[model samples]
Target: MQIKHQVVTRTPLGGFTLVEVLASVALISIVAAYFVHIQIQQVQERVVEALAQDVLTLANASMTYFSQTNEWPDQENGDCDDLIATLGGLGAFPVAVGGYQGPDGITLATRCEDTGDLGRTLLISVNFPFGADDQAQMLMSYLPTSVNEDVDDDEGPVVTHYVATPRRASERYRFYRIALEERGIFRLSKPDCPGRRNDPAHILLPQAICMPASAQGLGGYFFDEIDDDDDYWELQLLVADGEENNNVSDFMEFSGIPTCDGNRVYVGAITYCETR
Candidate 1:
C-alpha cells in the first residue's frame, strides 16, 4: 500500500495585489478631481452672472432714486462706503442678491459734490480681485443701448462717440470707464472733428484733450486703439447752478486717473440726474 500524500496549496483570497490597489486609487482620484473641477467652474459662472445682475440692479436703483427724488444718494467725498451707507439707509440697495455684498476696499474717487456737477458722477474703485478680470466685459454686455451704441458714420470715415450726448444721457444707461495698472489708461471719447464735434446737444467736444500719463497711472488716449469709431467719449463733468446751457469745456475736467501705490484700478460710471 503506497500512501500518497496530496499537497494542498492555499491561495490567499482576502486582499488585492499592489498594482491593482494603486490602479483603483488612481481611477477614483481622477473621477473625483473631474467632478470637483466641474463644480468649481459652475460656481464661478454663477458668481460672475450674479455680479453682473447685481450691478445692473444697483445702477437701475440709482437711476430710479434720482428720477423720483431729483437727486443722487448723498455721500461724503463720494466715498463708496458712504455711498453704500446712504443707499442702504434709503433702502435703495438690493437686499438678497447673491455675491452683491459691498466690496471690501472700494472708495469713491469723485462725485457730483466734488465736481459740483449737475449730473451725478460716481467714480468708485477697489483692488482688482484675483478672479474678476472678466467683470468689465460682463458689465459692458448689460449696458443699455444708449451707453452701448455703435454710432459709426460711413460718410468718408468711421465716427465713434463715447459718453452719450446730453440728449442721449437721458436714456437711463450708465457709462463706464476702466483704468488698468499694466495697460495704462483708456477711455471712450468723442472723435476728432469735422465729424460730430459741435453737435449742440453733445457735452464732449472734438478738441477735448486727454491727460498725459503721470506718476499715477492716470493718462492715456481717450479712444482705445482697436476701434476707430468707438462710442465712448471723454467725460467732462460741468457744474452750473440754474444754468441749463453751460459750456462743457468751461468746467473742471474729471481725469480718470488711478492711484500709483495700490494694485487697484478705477472703475467709474456717469448717470444723469434731473436737477431742473
Candidate 2:
C-alpha cells in the first residue's frame, strides 16, 4: 500500500458570485420603483376626480338656488369662503361635496352678471387659486368643455364677461376657471340704438353701438351675421315657456332689415342691424 492518504480538498458552500448578487439587488430595486410610480399615479387620478365631482356639486347647487330664489349666492362677491357662508345662510349650499374641506384658496366669483337679455342671470364661477398650476392644468385637460384657461377679457358667457385669472405680483399663477353658466346669447343692437351702448361687444370693439334688446322690454334677439342675405335671416331667441327655468329657443325669420321696433322678428326690437 503506497501511502494511501488521499489529498483532502475543501469547497465553499455558497455558489452565488459577487456580480450575480449585485445584479439581483438592482433588479429588485427597479421593480419596487415601478410599483411606487404606479401607486402615485393612481393617487393623483383619484384626487383630480374627487375635485371635479365636488365642483359639479357646487355648480348644480348654484343652479338650484337660482331657480328657487331667482338669485345667485354671490353676495360674498369674489371671496369663495364668504360666498359659501352666504349660500349656507340661505340654506342653498350642498350638504357635502366629496372631500371639500372649504374653499382652501379656491375663489368663487360672479362674472358677467345678468348676461343675455334675460335679466338678472346668475353667472357664477369657480376659480383655481394661485400656485395650483398642476391641479388646474389637470382639470382643464380632463374637462375641456367645462374648463377655461387664459381666456381674454370680454370672452366668456358674454362678451364683457372677461375671464382673467387672479395673479399675485410678478408670479402670475396659472389661470383656471369654470363658468357656472354656459355661453349665452349675445344681446345685439344696431347703431344709433335707443339705449346706452352697454353692449358687451363694446368692451373690445369700441365702435360697437348695439344695446341689449331686453333693455327695451323686448325678447332676446339672435345675431345674424349677414342680414342682407335672406338665407341667414333666422332669428334664434330663448323664450321661457311659462315654466320655471324652462327656456326653449324660438326661431323667427325676416326678409329685410328689421326696424328698431322689430318688424318680423320675435315681435321685439331688432337692434342688431342698420336699417335700410
Candidate 3:
C-alpha cells in the first residue's frame, strides 16, 4: 500500500527540433563551402605552376631542335600574337612585335601572322668553292636558330638552307665547336647526329635523324690546312624552318685555319653575331 503512493513524472523523449536540425545543416553547408573554396584556389595555383613549367620545357626543347636542324621557327616580322595564331608551333616566341624589331627584321613579322599550326621549313643551301683550298682545316660555325622565321627583302624571297659538305660521324667527327662566344664543349649549330646509316638518300629525307654529338664536334677536315697552293675558298650555310616560313637572319660560321710546314704558319678561329 505504501509503495503504491509513489508518484511517476513523465520524462520528455523528443530529439532535435526541426529548426535546430535545419540550423545544423546550414552550418555544415557553410563549412563545406569554405573547404571547397580552398580546394579551388589550390587547384588554380597548381595549374599556373604547371603552365610555367611547360613554357620552360618548350623553350629548351625548341632551342635544342633549332640547334640540331639549323632551322628556326614561329618567328616573323610583324606582331607575334597574330603570327603565332597561324603557327601554333611557336612556344615562347614573343607574340606581337612590341613596336620594336627583333634582331632580324623578318623574325618579328613572321612570328605575327595567323596560320593553321606551328611548323618548320626544311631548306638547306650550301656554298663550297673547291678551288680556294689554301690548305685550311674546313671549319663550320652555327648561329642561334629561331623557332619562327621570315624573309622580307628579296623579291620572291629566297628561303635559307643549311648543310655540311661531308656531314658524317666517322668522316669528320673531330673537335669543332661554334657559339655566340667561343667555348670548349659546344658544337656547331647543326644536327649533331648522323642517321644510323650515313648515305645521301637517307640524309635527304624530309626529317632526317639528327646525329649525336661528336666527341670533337667538327668534321675531321674539309680539305687540307696548308696554304702551299694559295687557294682561297669559303663555304656558307642557309637553313629554313619549312616551305612556308622563310629564313629570318643571315647566319655566319668560321672554318679553322691550320698552319702548314711549306706555308707561313697561320691558325685562326672565326667569330660572328646577330644582324638586327
Candidate 4:
C-alpha cells in the first residue's frame, strides 16, 4: 500500500459577513421599534381612558356631595389644587374613589351655586394646561357633545381647552342659570331638547322680556314668556315647585324640569357659572 500523502484541504473557519451582520441588526432594530411603538400607543390609550373615567368619577362624587350636603366640593374659583384641598386633600375624592390623583397635564375649574330650579348646582370644567394641545384633543373625544360642541367652528385645530359640566341634573341647573345670566336667554335648541323648537315656554327669556310683572331680576322662575303651551309651563312649574316631593315627578326628571322628549338638555352658550 503506497502511503499517498493525503493533502488535507484545511478550509478557514468562516465568520459572518459584514452585510449579514448589518442585516441581522437591522431586523432586530425593526422588531424592537415595532414593539416599542405598540407599547407607547397602549400606554397613551390607557392614560386617556383613565383620565376620562377619573373625570366622570370626580363629577359624580361632586354630584353626590351636592345631593347630600346641598353644596359642591370646591368654590367657584377653585382649581385642581383647591379641589384637592376641598376634598380633604390627597387620598380623598378621586384618589379615594379611583386611586387617581387626577389627570396629568390638566387643571380643574369648579363652581357650585344655588340655581333656583336645580337646588344645589355644581359645575366642573376640566381645562388643559397651556401647551397641552394633544391632551386637549384626546380629552375632547371622551367629553360629551355638550362640551365638544363648544369648540369654535372657525378655529385652527378645535383647541378644546374647556370641557363642559356633565348633563346630570345638578350640573344642568348650573349651566341653565349661567345661560340666563350671560345670554339673557336659555334656548335648548340642541337635539337633546325635547321639541328642539324655539317655543317661548321652552325658550327661557329674562324676566324683563317675558314676565315684566314678576321680579325684575332673574328670580326663581323657569319661563317668563307666556304662550298657549300649557304643557311647557307645567314643566317649568315642576322646577319651581318648592315641595321636595313634587319637585321631581320622575326620578329622571331633568333638573326637576319636565321635557317633551326627556332628552338631556343642552345649553351651549353657558360655559361656566360663578357661585353666589
Using TM-score, give the best candidate's number. Answer: 2
Q: Order of all candidates by TM-score, from best down to worst? A: 2, 4, 1, 3
What 10-residue stretch in candidate 3 is worst by lDDT?
Answer: 200-209
Instruction: Give the lDDT of residue 55 in candidate 4.
Output: 66
Model 1 agreement with the true structure over 29-148: per-residue lDDT tens digits: 999999999997777566546654555555566556555443455633443335445666678774433323534221112133233222335433222233343543443454433122
Backbone clash tally for model 3?
Answer: 62
Better of 2 and 3 by TM-score: 2
Winner by lDDT: 4
Report the error of model 4 at residue 211, Å: 41
Candidate 2 segments whose C-alpha is farther than 4 A from its true place: 75-82, 94-132, 151-276
TM-score of each: 0.37, 0.42, 0.30, 0.40
Could you tell me how far off, in angstroms, the CA of residue 275 lies in candidate 4 after the best superposition? 24
TM-score of 2: 0.42
RMSD of 3: 24.6
Question: What lDDT does candidate 2 reach at residue 49?
Answer: 71
Write model 2 residue lDDT over 92-141, tens digit each, in one string: 56444532353345545544343333333333354655555565666555
lDDT of model 4, residue 221: 35
lDDT of 3 by residue, 1-276 (tens): 455567899999989999999999999999999999999766645543443333333344444444543333333333323333333444443444453122212221222122212223222211112331111111111212312123343322222222121222213222222221121112132222233333111111111111234444422212111122212212222222223222233212222322123232222332221111
What lDDT tens digits, residue by residue, belong to model 4 across residues 28-91? 9999999999998778777767777766666666655544433455544553335545664534
Alpha-carbon runs more than 4 Å astray in model 4: 1-14, 69-105, 112-123, 129-132, 145-276
